[model samples]
Target: MIWQIELIILVLVVLFGFGALATKDLLSAAILFGAYSFLLCLLWAIMGAVDVAFTEASVGAGVSTVLIVSAVLRTTRRTDH
Candidate 1:
């Protein structure tokens, strides 16, 4: 595994994590979380953990993301002053 690629992925994961936490919008946060999960899947693949990578891609990035987005979409976004 190339350290350079891994390092780049790591940086992206951190950025996505912070983005998810910092975003005020629920949909944006969910999307960022999905991206973070995808990045983790890539890292796992690079580390030779194919099974883990597949699970992360399918469950973490795929199903989880969809569920989050759906839930976000169904919720009201109004804020009380």
Candidate 2:
């Protein structure tokens, strides 16, 4: 049962990772990246690496998302094809 749960989490991480990379909008991408990071943190925690997971949550998902969103705020989400 635990392995099945882990597998589902792993699949989510992969899907979110790809979603982040594939999105054309910067804001969407940034948010997806944050979600990806959060999922990664969850995966790490599930694997018994609580310390690393905490760091990823605080740094990867938290601080980095704020930074990226702020940077986006200063600019625009428009992309010129």
Candidate 3:
């Protein structure tokens, strides 16, 4: 049962990662990346690493995602290259 839960989280993380990479919109990609981080943090928590999970949840899901989205909003979505 525990392994199954881990597998599900792993699959969700992979899907979110792919979605982030495939998305054309910077904001959408940032949101997907945040989702990926949330899933990873959940997996870590389930695996008994509470401190690491807390850090990942706070920094990755909360701070990093918000910062990335804010940066995207401040800049152009299109790349010159």
Candidate 4:
């Protein structure tokens, strides 16, 4: 059961990675990156690295996402056309 849960999280992280890269909108991509980081935190916690998971959750998902979203809000989401 634990292995199955880990497997699903791993898959979700991979999917989020691809989705982040594929998204054209900066906000959407940033959100997908946050989701990827969250899944990565889960993976680390499951692997007995709770400290690393906590850091990843707080820094990667929280601070970085907020920074990215704020930057996106300040600027344009679309590229030069």
Cα error of candidate 1 at position 23, Å: 0.2
- lDDT (0 to 1) per candidate: 0.91, 0.91, 0.91, 0.92
Best by lDDT: 4
TM-score of each: 0.91, 0.90, 0.88, 0.92
Residues 1-81, candidate 1: write the lDDT tens digits: 778988999999999999998887888899999999999999999989999999999999999999998888888542224
Candidate 1, residue 35: Cα displacement in angstroms equals 0.5
Query: In model 3, how large is the Cα lDDT of residue 13?
Result: 95
Assess candidate 3 and give its lDDT: 0.91
Q: Pairing residues by index, what is the TM-score of model 4?
A: 0.92
Error of 1 at 18 (Å): 1.0
Candidate 3 backbone overlaps, count: 0
Per-residue lDDT, model 3, residue 79, is 48
Candidate 3 TM-score, true structure as reference: 0.88
**Runs off by more than 4 Å, candidate 2:** none
Candidate 4 scores a C-alpha RMSD against the true structure in Å of: 1.4
In candidate 1, position 55 carries an lDDT of: 100
Better model by lDDT, 1 or 4? 4
Please, what are the lDDT tens digits per residue for candidate 3 over residues 1-81? 378888889999999999998888888899999999999999889888999999999999999999999899899885444
Off by over 4 Å in 1: 78-81
What TM value does model 1 have? 0.91
A best-first ranking of the candidates according to their TM-score comes to 4, 1, 2, 3
